[model samples]
Target: MEKLLKAERISYHADGKKVLENCHIELRRGEIVLLLGPNGSGKTTFFKCIAGILKHSGNVFVDGVNASKMKAHERFRLGVVYSPEKMRVAENLSVKENLAITGDVNEAVEFFPELKKLLKLKAGNLSGGERQLVVLARSLISKPKYLLLDEPFAGLSEKAFERVLKILVEKSEEMGIAIITHERVESVLPYVTRVYSILSGKIVSVIEENFEKELKRYLLID
Candidate 1:
């Protein structure tokens, strides 16, 4: 399959300090790619570069076109969506209102039926997991072709985590996905088709098979 998003030689500097160097990555439809690294490993910075949020040095192509100079909304128009690790929503707005701001939530609710009952409640009133569901639902509602998620599983119970994972798996059949999560390695291992391990802002290893062993070998798990 042709890659939906391609980034090459991606490097970034912050406050005169190098944060990422010569990073390359690609995403294709119908597969879920997991990005693993410790804190300060430049995972979030990498995602921002792809999403066109942070100015960086690199060639980013979407659907065979150069997106290196595109803005965040332009990238969104091209079907690339990045959800930051810090979940954001209008606290005073109702759950339904937040999702409605993006678009129709019918399909979003289909992916997360749990949101049906909580639609009327204020977004701030919901629990962490519930807020996550709202955020994921809103993202899916946009129908992005390449979805970059940073810590989508933060603040969730085991059952809630499983629910979100299932939704991601189902969505991967139609859209390209990349996820950055630092928790529940065992639970996420089975769902990913490939894994990229990054350290000190550079990709160190990529594992396509024997994830459990390779993850340990790469020191992503101990």
Candidate 2:
């Protein structure tokens, strides 16, 4: 249960407007943490800051190493992987070629065999769901110690969502995982160990498993 990542008094601003202020978070190894928030609640911004894609005023430590002080590639060596909501694959490359280009072809194929069959197909020709699976597979190939997912379940059918969720849970058991989602929390409630609700750029509340009943009361889910 050691802390793999910690943030203290973090703040960020854009266009002279504050996006996050005095926010704090701690992520322990082998735990699945869900970040729940409405749109523009700063969930995406917070993850980007942690991933070193954005600059913020605060202390972010990955395995006790200051994230801001480390170079982007150095942070990747520490097993921090962030998968944004949008796809970033090369349209001209084949599915397998894209994985190879990312240096994760072997591992990705092992996790998602469905992609293995479509290895020769161009990425641009794949369905949205298939493309997402490739992204998920690639993220796992990084063998990240901390995985940050932004709306990973978006644009998936129920069956596909369950399949992806299964992979996420399996991977989380091996590493720390944080997911930000605005969809129904119930879909992932059973697998989540803790939950943080963000509102207006601040963490409104932190809920643990022990407070399940109370949390549901607050969520108004009968």
RMSD of 1: 1.5
Give the worst 10-residue stretch by lDDT in candidate 1. Answer: 82-91
Tens digit of lDDT per residue, candidate 2, span 1-222? 365878777899999999998877777777889887778889999988888788888888888777866655677788788888876667799998888855678788777778878999999998888888887877888778898988888777788888888888887777899998755567788888888877799987888865457556556244
Question: Best by lDDT, which number?
Answer: 1
lDDT of 1 by residue, 1-222 (tens): 466789999999999999999988889889889889989999999999999999999899998989999998999999999877867777899989999987797777887888999889899898877888788888888889999999999888888888889888988999999999988878888878889889999998888999999888877888
Model 1 regions more than 4 Å off: 1-3
Clash pairs, model 2 backbone = none
